[model samples]
Target: MYEFVTGPLAWIAFGIFIIGMTVKVISVIRLASKKDKVVFNHWSWGWSFRSVYRWLIPFGSRSMREKPVLTIVFFVFHVCLLAVPIFLLGHNILWDERWGITWWSFSETSADYLTLLLMAAAIVLILRRIVLPEVRIVTTAYDYLLLAIAVAPFVTGYFAYHQWFDYKTVLIIHILCGEIMLIAIPFTKLSHMILFFFTRAHIGSEMGERRGAKTW
Candidate 1:
């Protein structure tokens, strides 16, 4: 069971993740190209690329000042979310063990703290959906499920690392949850992982060119 979970299952998950992302990206490009090739070429690609930094980082935009607390929470949340998995010592060690790819990584203690922060941020985002009237009105089971999908892997990983539960059980759950997240990204709203910058870039270019009468 361990061998299958650690080896073949991991490879299958990776394959699915790669194929799914490729299909999603190609579809987006096709749709946008079909909509209007002219709009894509009219803007300077360099400027659009440059604008990605400001759009991705909430602190870079003055509009984010309206919801300062939420802005800070999300900024920190995204940082930890993106960092913990890639930088965690366990994951890095596994990468080296499995593929002989060596890289520096955060110490175990640092990863623990970051993992905690990630879970906290997920909880906060969930509570915001439930507690905020405007947000709650639009909230659905699917929204909460997406948050669960985002949080489950880390929660299980933390337990697996700490031996909080049966190590094998928690570890298996961790791997499964991580695989589920990878596969879901290209299909669900989680596609935002890839789409976020592209959409932002398109908006930035359009607004920069005054293509629309007003800025968002």
Candidate 2:
């Protein structure tokens, strides 16, 4: 089980992730090609190249600065989502051992804290969906499921690493859940992980150039 999960499944998941992202990128480019040039701001095609960097900062634009709660939620969730997994000491160690590649790692204690903050953010978003009337109207099962898929790996991983449950079983569950997330990214609404860049960049460029607004 260990060998299969760590070896074959890992490779399979990586392949799927790469292929899926490539396909999604192609789809976006094709869709963009069909869009009328008049629809975008007067700026050159490279506008997003500059404007995206600005809006990427939390509350960087006049529109977003007014909604600090939303900005905090958006910023914190993405940060912890990427940071916790990439910087976890355990993951870096495994990478070095498996592929002979090594990178900096965060202290395990820091990773743990970040993971907790991530889970908390997930809960807050979930509760908002349930409680807010306008949001609840638009929310769907797919949304909640996506949240669960995103959270499952770290949820199981934390338990396994902390030995809060059956260690062997929880560890297997953690590996399985992480692989599942990787495989599902392109196929699910989780595709937003990649799409967020395209959509946000387009919006930022349009607003910044057309309205003479600075996201920064």
Query: lDDT at 208 for candidate 2?
Result: 65
- Show where candidate 2 strays beyond 4 Å: 35-46, 208-216
lDDT of 1 by residue, 1-216 (tens): 777777888888888888988898999889889986866865656556656777576767766777888888898788888888888888888878887886779988988998998888888898899899999999999999898988899999989988997999889889899988988888899989888877777767776654532222
* Tens-digit lDDT track of model 2 for 89-206: 9989988989998889999888888888888898889998999999899999999998999999989988987998789889888999999999999999888888877876676567
Q: What count of clashes does model 2 give?
A: 1
Alpha-carbon lDDT, every model:
0.82, 0.83
- Name every residue pair that clashes in candidate 2: 60-215
Worst 10 residues of 1 by lDDT: 207-216
lDDT of 2 at 4: 86
Off by over 4 Å in 1: 211-216
| True-vs-predicted CA distance for residue 185, candidate 1, Å | 0.6
* Clash count, one per candidate: 0, 1
TM-score of 2: 0.90
- Cα RMSD to native, each candidate? 2.0, 2.2
